[model samples]
Target chain A: MAEQDLTSSSILIAQAQTDTGNSEAQQPGNAAGTNDAVEEQVVQEANDAAQGITVVVEGSEVVAADPAVELHAETQGAYTEQEKSVFPPFDSSTFGPQLFWLALTFGVLYLLMSKIALPRIGEILEVRRDRIEGDLAEAERLRQKTDQAIEAFEAELAEARAKSHGIADETRAKIKSEMDAKRRDVEADLAKQVATAEARILKTKTDALANVDQIAAETAVAVVGKLAGKVSIKDARVAVSDVVKG
Target chain B: MAGTDPISQFKVKTLFSFGTIGADENGANGVDLVFTNSALFMVLTVGLIATYLILSTRGRGLVPSRLQLVSEMSYEFIANMVRSSAGTEGMKFFPLVFSLFSFILIANMWGMFPYFFAVTSQIIITAALALLVMAVVIIYGVWKNGFGFLKLFVPSGIPLPILFIVVPIEVLSFLSRPLSLSLRLFGNILAGHIVLKVFAGFIVSLSALGALGMFGSILPFVMAVALTGLEFLVSALQAFVFAILTCIYLNDAIHPGH
Candidate 1:
């Protein structure tokens, strides 16, 4: 209301200024129509500026012709009593509606979230989780299979190593037994040859002894004629026998 | 002229009357339930949340899209908070906590837009929300723990002498939950926005001054820009704080012990 009054007052001032200018133009010695037109133009500009202020700011009013200082003062005073009551947030008049709408909207949000929105999101998450878990389980199974295959390969390797060691041992034993049998047969042949030579030497010694006794007997008969040679041969044989027995 | 007055931004103008209940000497001053910009934004907030949550997961891919991933992360973030603070049994309140979290976070984000109404900025609105949370805590606390809920005030392992001092403080803090919860959000938003408007208004006023003033306006212009970024952070942070605080209070209701 104050702003409208101020705007109307400014329009009145503009009209009064135009009227004075028009009356002055009509007086003698005053500039004619041109002067009135210039005055009207200035007044029109002022009217426009004031109307502009009214349009820009509603409650706080100042005369359009006021200097910057007064304009600042008016601007400072803009927070009037009406502004206090009309402050949107604290305005008690809006509370009922704000509350009503808050409840209605928030309630709708809750119902939508709880019933539809969130569950759907959760189901998506659950599906993703299940997928990841399944993939992990499959991976674990493959790793286990790989481990078992590796274990079997190692077992085979160990068995082959043990079999090769057994074969080497058997070959070594067979070679050693064959060499031992060949050495035993050669030793037995040498022993038999030596015994036979010894038996022949003993037989030759006995025959030589018998021949000495007969030669001694024949020599004694011849020696009886040739002196004591025969008697000496028989005596020599007996002496030899007695000496051998002794 | 009141554009410089930051408080003007928060003023609730009635777009239309829903219905009037207590019609009095002032024909409209009755329980004139009007849908307002605030109300519209509230609906928008709810609508945005619902649409995103519902539509993003429509694909239900084993590998989620970016939108679906964000929704899942938000869900898990709130879910973890509730679970960690209140434990597994408190998962019972998941929907409620989820709803509150989404409502606050989305509403705060909407407020970040220039010329958009911040639902969280309203004292009545924040107060009502705080009261609602407290109501849940108190009612659920009492119902779940019976008289044992009072044990939340009397922490265990305190000496008898100290409890005399401590118990009352606990109860006082408990009683002030709604006040603190509501004011924390309201004050932060109100102050942040007011500061932003003030600085923004400064740029306009200063630029009106000649060339040198234009250079001077640069400072406020930068300040306003920086403040906008901070406001975005604050919007998200306030929502996070509100959610975590709700979980903590729910925990008190769940266990009702120190």
Candidate 2:
């Protein structure tokens, strides 16, 4: 409503200014037209001046000018002494020197109100609104910054976790491969030792058998004389060799 | 001193009877402390305005009651007055202008009551109102436009020789505002009241009588009634004029050269 009023008033003022401008432009050319208007005003004033002279009309002393003269006269000066007594002048001074004081008093009061009271009210309201707006904007900005930081931290944390999991898996695979190679080498050495031991056992048995036969033959030659003793040695050597083979 | 007679006499002297308060040092006890007659009416006028405004505004609603409508109407009326004369730039002064209108309207209507005195009848009151309005124009104009407001006193597009003659006339007219504004209201209201009083006293003095005499009495009574209504219009109008002029003055203050 207030805005509308301001707009309407501005429109009216603009319209008025335009009208005034147009009239001003036309004034110079229309100066002759006002000459008749001036003459008419003079005639009217002359008639009014002549109104003071009275002439009898009907039963009353009406002025020659018009009935308005008679009406004016009767209103101003018609009352006689008896009529005057009926009406008394009100002694209230409406137009005395009091006007100056009134103007002075009003001037001071208006000045105080316009300068002091109004400005204070306006200033307080403006400051409050500004403070509220500033606080809101600051809070919103802070909230946005916090949200961005949280998002960035979460993204980095996820990347770190993935990298650690990859490293752990690679270390486990390397350890498993080395353990397999060591196991193979140990198994091969143990197999070689078993084979060599078998070979040695075979050679010792063969050699013992050959030595026992030769010794048994010599003992037999000698034992021809000694009979059963040499035969018993060769039998003993054969028994020992069969035992070793088993 | 004649005691009560002195007090009563004092009431007649000073503007709105400050003499009574001033004369308290001499004598007359405290009888003059309480307001009476015209002063009493002045108080009544203020009360009437206050009461009406309060009652009209109470229980305010979006749709509005009849009383609220009147209150809003008064606000809108003065608001338009300021906006029209002062433009959008002048709307900041709405509250002040509206208050002036309401106060004057109440004062004028209060006079119609049998025992009330019209504040506008007092030159001091009218002049003070005018001064307040004029001061707002000058002060706010200068405040907003700075030294530019001085251009109001010096019109544009004049021959160098004419500048001296035209500028003084414009300055004098500018200075005459408070005088013209205060006097117009003071004279109109004062004259109307005096006419009413004289005619009313006549009605009292003349015994209700023969056909013509009775008919003659009716004329003053009718005139008085009509004048009462006109006085109401004048009261609102004078306040409006005062505010509008304030806006115009403010406009000059705002846009000095134009």
Best by lDDT: 1
Candidate 2, CAPRI quality class derived from DockQ: incorrect
Give the per-residue lDDT of model 2 (tens digit) for A1-246.
334444554555555455555555656566655745654554455444334221112213222233443232222312121221111212323222234343433344335435643343334435655877898999999999999999999888888888888888878887877887888878888788877887888788888777776666555556654754445555655655565566
Candidate 2 lDDT tens digits, B1-258: 122121121122222333323234434322222223444444455455555655655554444688766655665676677777778877777657655665566667776665455667766677777887788778887887788888887778777899989888888998898899889887877777666666665565443666677767777778778877776777677766766776777677667885
Candidate 1 local lDDT, A1-246, one digit each (tens): 566667676776777686766667666476658666767776786677677656655534333323333232222211223335345667655566789899999999889988998888888888888989999999999999999999999999999898888888888888778877877777777777777777777677777777766666555556664774335555656755665568
lDDT of each: 0.80, 0.59
Best by DockQ: 1
- Per candidate, native contacts kept equal 0.76, 0.04
Tell me how each candidate scores on DockQ against the true complex: 0.30, 0.02
DockQ of 1: 0.30
Best by TM-score: 1
lDDT of 2 at B115: 45
TM-score of each: 0.72, 0.46
